[model samples]
Target: MIPNSGIAITIDIGDEHFIHAPKKKEVADRLLFNALNQTYGYNTVDYAAPIFNSQEKKNGGIVLKFKNAETGLYSYEKLNGFEIAGEDKVFYPAKAKIVGRKDVFVISDDVPNPVAVRYAWRNWVVGTLYNAMLLPTSSFRTDNWDDAIKAKK
Candidate 1:
């Protein structure tokens, strides 16, 4: 697991096509800029993407808060890629939105008593959540409880 310290560097390699090959230099430049500004402290920079900070239960839904989101949050397109679950431990696709600055509210009709939430949990997820700096949020799960498969063993 990568620690939340300011020493980490993240880079997005993008797609595998001729059209994207030309963009590699741009991506590398951006990554270098982030590293210089964030890790080396050359200047004040928004280095890391916003990360999950906390959550709260509210009227049958879950409100998620984030750190490293001082500039606020957004999505490249419509918000998606969130899931919620109840005590049954069955996760279902959820509706999510940015509320206030760094808070995301998630809810699912299938999970009325949600106890946990996950974002971009799929193997090949196309996540959209990002900070105002346009850095994407990483996949995250709110619960550490053992899976049902483990419990059944």
Candidate 2:
């Protein structure tokens, strides 16, 4: 998860007031981060955990199960780059969609008997999945293959 924090300023004016600032989006984002981190005392609001524990092969695809899903399972704003691998251990681009259950998703690339699934598992890609809290899921892979990127580094 992206580390963030917030700051709280007290004014002796003794009244609640709304302050609007005309700033760039990124500037506003930074301010919001600091405000949230300072107010919530870190790692409390909109926190996400990577803990997918179950996977199943079905309908020429892979099904990922997220247990104890709070805020209803959902995807992010942009297209999520998903990859799937079969027994041959070669990953291919795939797409993810929420299936019957809120905590279940079907990732499909049409690979027969898919064995593994990953989401936004790249150095720079938009994440597509989130929980009810609107916290983005970190890049992750279900395979245990030698990390080529790590090896190169």
- Give the top-scoring candidate (TM-score): 1
Worst-scoring 10-residue span by lDDT in model 1: 4-13
In order, the Cα lDDT scores of the candidates are 0.75, 0.56
Runs of candidate 1 with Cα error greater than 4 angstroms are 1-23, 148-153
| Model 2 per-residue lDDT tens digits across residues 65-91 | 764355466764533577777777767
Clashes of 1: 0
Instruction: Kindly report which residue pairs in candidate 1 clash with one another.
Output: none
Which pairs of residues clash in candidate 2, taking residues 3 or more apart in a chain or in different chains?
Answer: 5-33, 5-34, 5-37, 6-34, 6-35, 6-37, 6-38, 7-34, 7-35, 71-132
Q: For all candidates, what are the clash counts?
A: 0, 10
Relative to the unseen true structure, what is the C-alpha lDDT of residue 4 in candidate 1, on a scale of 0 to 100?
25
Cα error, candidate 1, residue 24 (Å): 2.7
